[model samples]
Target chain A: MPDTLFKPRMNADIKRRSYYSKFIFNSHFLIFLTIAGGVFLYSLLGLLQTLESSIWLDMIAALLMSMLLLPGYRSLLKPADGIFLLPYETRMDAYFKDAGRYSLMLGISKVITGAVVALLILTVGHDTFVISLFLLLSLLHYIANFHINKRAINTQISRIGMTPVLFIVNILSLMLVLQHPAWLVLSLILLFAMGKYVKRREHRYLDWNAYIEHEEVQLNRYYRNVSMFTNVSHLEKQFKRRKYLDPLLWKPKGASFNKEKMYEFLFYRTFARDHDLPMIILRLIILFGIIMVWMGNIYLSVVIGLFGIYVIVLQMSQIYSAQAYLLWPKVWPVDRTFIQRSYVTYSHKSVFVISLIFGIIFAAIHPALFYIAVVFPVWGYLTNRIFSRTVYKKEQELSD
Target chain B: MVLQIEHLTGGYSKTPVIHDVSLNINKGEIVGLIGLNGAGKSTTIKHILGLLRPHSGEIRVDGITIGENAEDYRRHLAYIPETPVLYEELTLKEHIQMTAMAYGIGEETALERAGDLLKIFRLDTKINMFPTHFSKGMKQKVMLVCAFLARPDLYIIDEPFLGLDPLGIDSLIDLMVEERNGGRSILMSTHILATAEKYCDRFAIIDNGKMVAEGSLDALRDEFNMHGASLDEVYLKITGGGIDNA
Candidate 1:
């Protein structure tokens, strides 16, 4: 064993590992699981059927909860934290191969769960063709997992690449149903074969660097979106500060005396840098805009508000992902007064921003329902302030 | 005394890495902690810094135990970890500011002190740069600046010379001497016995989590019966027997 095997030569590596470990395990994994699990549950619950336009929307949601969420789940759930195990460069192949297999198992599980949910929901209407299609696709996706796992182990194939080519082929198969039957079936089989082939090629080469790079990109992307969701200002500050971002710099007049301003700094920074917020925003814009244009149900607006609540929770969790615990000011002669005050202000500011956006959007949906939106934002802001303040106080007490 | 560790026995958890290790340094003194890997130099430092909970010992910083008032106890000491730990999101300026804020330095004083320290470390141009952009030596410089910002009574530095260029190493030694002259104490760990021998006022040698030997060059030399020999000679005489270099 090298003298430095367990001992990091530098404090930075130890500190970085320490800091990131908290994030990867506690905050990052928790948030990923929460979002993925919540969506899966929501889809399973058949909650969106109230706004039910077509079976296609439900299918899409199920598909999203399966494919996109699984990729995310895979990233967080994989053994990135146990990187020390791969200390021997010679063992990298075997180590990552196991990791790849683990990822594939997770992917297969997600595919199976999704198919079961789809089958249950679709079987109620008794569409034999669609039912058969779902099963066929599920089986193909499951079989494709070994390939996906191999690809991940061998190469830099992204989540973007790991997408079910069979799903697209099935859709194409659907499109070509009337004109060319045999070719459609053949295309679907070929697409599955291609996915399997690419996966094999990836395994054959075992491109460790590429796989690591791919994983890094996925993590960065996730963190970026989460950071954006949590604090838009922080993200902007890190990147290029937009002229529009400057307006938020001014502390709301009366609240200026309060530490909300400090939180605003952290909040804005969190959203701007995290991955969850931007993903949520993109999701909200695409989802809500579509619902408004097509469905236009006032009741669905309530659903949107609830979804916004989920989004807000996700955004808040991203702050936790930054793992402030590892950055304990205990080592420094930090001003207890300032940290105490700033902690409260930070959480409050986050709540206020979330409530404001949800309130304004919900109110804009209908002028008559403006009170619900208004009350919700105000109530949420105050409640979160009180709750988070208590939590911070309690933590401080524990530390003391 | 600047730092005092008495009977410290702690490690990751349950199993102790440092077994009843006791050591101390007075004001204006430079003490070296020398050990092979897994000999628990870092663990000993962690106890002194109060980062670890001693299963059976007491750690005092400038005459106050960490249990008395952790925050206040910390005020007397600054630490340079073996590897630099920086906030990737924060710019170098922000890191300095954060450190300043934590230490309760006024913003103006923090900035002024930060400026001087940055210049001293030859990092004036990189204040606006994020730590993510810093090279290994530059990151180490940032950690050094942060540690020096407080000018505490004691500096508990772990593996200070790693990743430093020869000039950087020289400057660090100069800084250590300068700080000691200013009535601060430094307890540092290193594999570089020659530098440690040249600069340290006293030395403690730990092996297998136990203190094998300690004292000034002459004292160690006398103890090991190697008269007028260097610290290395004494060190080798004490530890070279049946010890795996690997």
Candidate 2:
């Protein structure tokens, strides 16, 4: 067999490409990026002007050391991979070795970037010896950390025990390099020896489950970050039932139930139980609320409030499409039109509630913007109507 | 006929897995679809459930083709997939209620049937628990309950015995028989030859995307010249004989 392990990675890359093509080229993304870039430049210039060289060096060292804690391999091992790929374990050694090299290259770039940032802040005459020594120590720390992590995968050493020890050692090695460069070579030799010892002592059995779990965590983290920008097709969402939010989904006892009513209830419960939709709405509201209060520009705040509502509405609309992947919905006896109507109705209610809160917060911050309380609901209703119509039209095309 | 599949040929993609296969189940009849793994059992089931469009054939439920009236056709059939597919967030009771709502089952009827099925499967006590933490067998039981609760005119069940406990299996057979006696039809696919032989009114044996033989046990015995042979023997002889002949 040809190395089939790359198939999953290839599929993921295809999904990622489609996702970016749909969202990254949009005007909303461009606007968001422009605002973010402006904020980042403002912060960077201020930090360079105010922070001292010593503090910058300390921060860089801490950051570079922390980066070493990340895993040094991307096995891309999914759950099914255990059964499918475990049979070819002996042949997979080369694949894993390549993954380790790739991870090390990524780590090197992160360390170099941090070091360059520190150099820019320390613009005055800097010690060449110290800089070179820091780079060498950082490289050694990365290699040693990678070996330790690989060993921990199949070894008696608990990750809880090994992680702290490795972190302290990495930090101490860097500190020694800065203060006393002569002792740096000795520390590197000792770290390399320890890494070799760990490798030699570790059990040979492959823990495919742990590897798959680790890879999934890494992949999920990447997908979750990308999901903030656009919908990710393969991201498995986490679900949580917030009991305190139950009252929000409650219906009166002995209430009459119909197809539409049941659909409405189901949609409500799905939204409340899902970890992403509700959290995304709350995050946008809080972020906009803080920016509005901090900037205290009534016009700008109102504009942002409107834009925030738009973004939330767009994201919330994803719930309607989400159920399409499920079987029960497609197999349900109810007409597709009724299902669409229920989705539109429930989404409108959710958006209205969210926009009302945004309006209340904006009014509280700037009493002059009290008109937002009225304007927000009207705008939300109109947007919901327009978005729902577009969504339904697209769905109609797909079904046809 | 409650269910009719005419010259159905389809798969995941353009290339067909099950080719030109035809089968039917009449009212109050139970038909067993028996085949080995990757022998197009699931592909056939998928065609019947309207999950996959037939490459070049038609499937009908209650005399209405899936393409002619998708919603109405779906309403007439209840499907139990080989692997249990349940929403992780929904409790056991919620699953049954959702199925009831989807099928438009009356509240009183739903309540009565759900109560009885839950008790029969010994899942009554766990009605409030989410299936997220359910064992494999428990999850299968939940799927069984969902399908049973639908009470549709036709039940398309695929490999219903896997991951089910012995008692759960017995309860399922009993419920399926009860449904059949009540004038509902069932088309079940399984690798469990003995169980299928015991419960099925007739058997349709498929191989390499083709139906090799389909009839009552006596008819199959007569055709294969395996007089008095068990269903298992007949299956092995047919498939093994095909390989040898090929």
Candidate 3:
């Protein structure tokens, strides 16, 4: 090879930004936000913004904030996360030195931030034991986090399933600190020792392939959920990149009558049998609950109900957004009727029916306002009529 | 007739990817489609599958036009996409059963065929497992199994061999031969000239949305005046030499 043409491989540092970005958008962030936001909003509103309501909420806020600070605090796992720099296995010790400094700083930052927040809340009670215990528990949380994170980064085990285990341990420790004051320092030391042991054991023997594979799997699942916001293909591409997406779902088992039937089958299989429906259901419930909570007056309830209707309609529209024929129909064994009929039957009619079902359910929940139910059929008709005449027509016209 | 395309001219939009393309595969024939990355192989397959409508052409399955009876037209052909498009929600077995139901294949037969396919693909252990857990090769195998389970008259497969292990490739070749011998026709597009040369009875080389040269390997070799050359040599000579006008 010519000396001038020789190019060194790209360093892993450059790839770390994109990798961490995937974690930020993963469902874990969403779950964390739901928990943190719910508590914050409830405390602010329900307690009339009282500064000294409950210690547990403050503890939760600390935990949630610690999670948010993870990107910055990831340096604490230098021993485990540094394995990426091991290709030059000779310089592994040098990489570990830098990584350890990074991890300790990050680990300390998380511990301090959490301890301060908990201490602020604990100050209202003016109990030294409460403040000391909260600090100890906060330290234990960082230690526990460092341990699991190293295990996950090293072993490539999914961190999502491990979260519940971590959460249980965390909650148990928090309870012990809050309700039992004597064992706080001892427990904190024990947790730190445990985390150190895990890091040492992980460093002793590591399987890089298993770790890389697990990381991609975790990243794909995270990215897949996030990609829904902007694009489905992005998520699809992520799975493709990770070699994670499976083809077993849409495999041909037998004959489809024609392209139309094939499309209809896809539409049904995509929506009715797919997870998007349950997701749709969940969003509806959440929105309904929010509306119910804020429905202080009748007028507000109706306004929320109308907004709910729009949300349902919007959600139903998303059901058909994943059209495979848009990309993969070149070798399909059917006709133009399949495309045309699929739009009319699959996208147009199906969404209309789903909106109606949801609309009626929303109406039944508030029967005192029976007049809202009138929008059920009107919205259904109007949506379909508008979609068929404009969108569906545009689709067909473009098809030609 | 197993599959037929006449004067097909269509693409994503008005810009036709396949122009006036015509081809046919009768019962028991394996017709290979050869092309470069952007050679419109997939577009032509899309037209045949009814994913796209020709600006001016007709595609028929079993002598019946697709538009005249949409259901019947799709019933006759099974398609395996280059990259299998599968639902993330459904389990592997559920995918098989649902497809069987759509095609109106009896449940018992679908299950038996599915089981056999799973065994052949070494996926018998993962029947209940979701595609989420499957490897790329495993997912591709799942797609193949699903297509094979259809047992349609025409099998339209695109880039069938990519991502397969040697065992998988061998099994696929055996399956293709078995399917063809059993009176089924196959329309497959591939860049693996060696594999196509070995298996395909006839072939059509398409370039930039136009049919460049099409015939048996011997005929293609003779046309290029490279009698003893392999399919790769013939292909390179024909493509590198440029398309001679019909």
| lDDT tens digits, residue span B52-109, model 1 | 7889988888788977887789888888988888765556876675666556566577
Candidate 2 CA-lDDT value: 0.76
- Cα lDDT tens digits, model 3, A314-337, are 444444444532543433334445
Query: What lDDT does each candidate get?
Result: 0.63, 0.76, 0.64
Q: What would the TM-scores of all predictions be?
A: 0.71, 0.80, 0.58
TM-score of chain B of each: 0.95, 0.96, 0.95
**Superposition error at B118 for model 3 (Å):** 9.7
> Residue B185 deviation, candidate 2, in Å?
1.6
Q: List the candidate 3 regions with Cα displacement exceeding 4 Å.
A: A1-148, A155-165, A172-184, A204-232, A236-280, A283-318, A324-400, B1-29, B34-78, B82-85, B88-155, B159-186, B190-201, B205-213, B217-246
In candidate 2, what are the lDDT values of residues A285-313, reduced to their tens digit? 99978876765667666767777787777
Question: Which candidate wins on TM-score?
Answer: 2
* i-RMS for every candidate: 4.9, 1.9, 6.6
Model 1: residues with Cα > 4 Å off, grouped in runs: A1-170, A178-205, A208-271, A275-307, A314-324, A335-340, A382-400, B6-22, B55-58, B207-214, B240-246
Total backbone clashes of model 1?
37
List model 3 lDDT by residue over B107-136, tens digit each: 678889999888888998887766756888
Clashes of 3: 16
Tens-digit lDDT track of model 2 for B146-199? 888888999988888999989989999999999999999899999898999999
Candidate whose lDDT is highest: 2
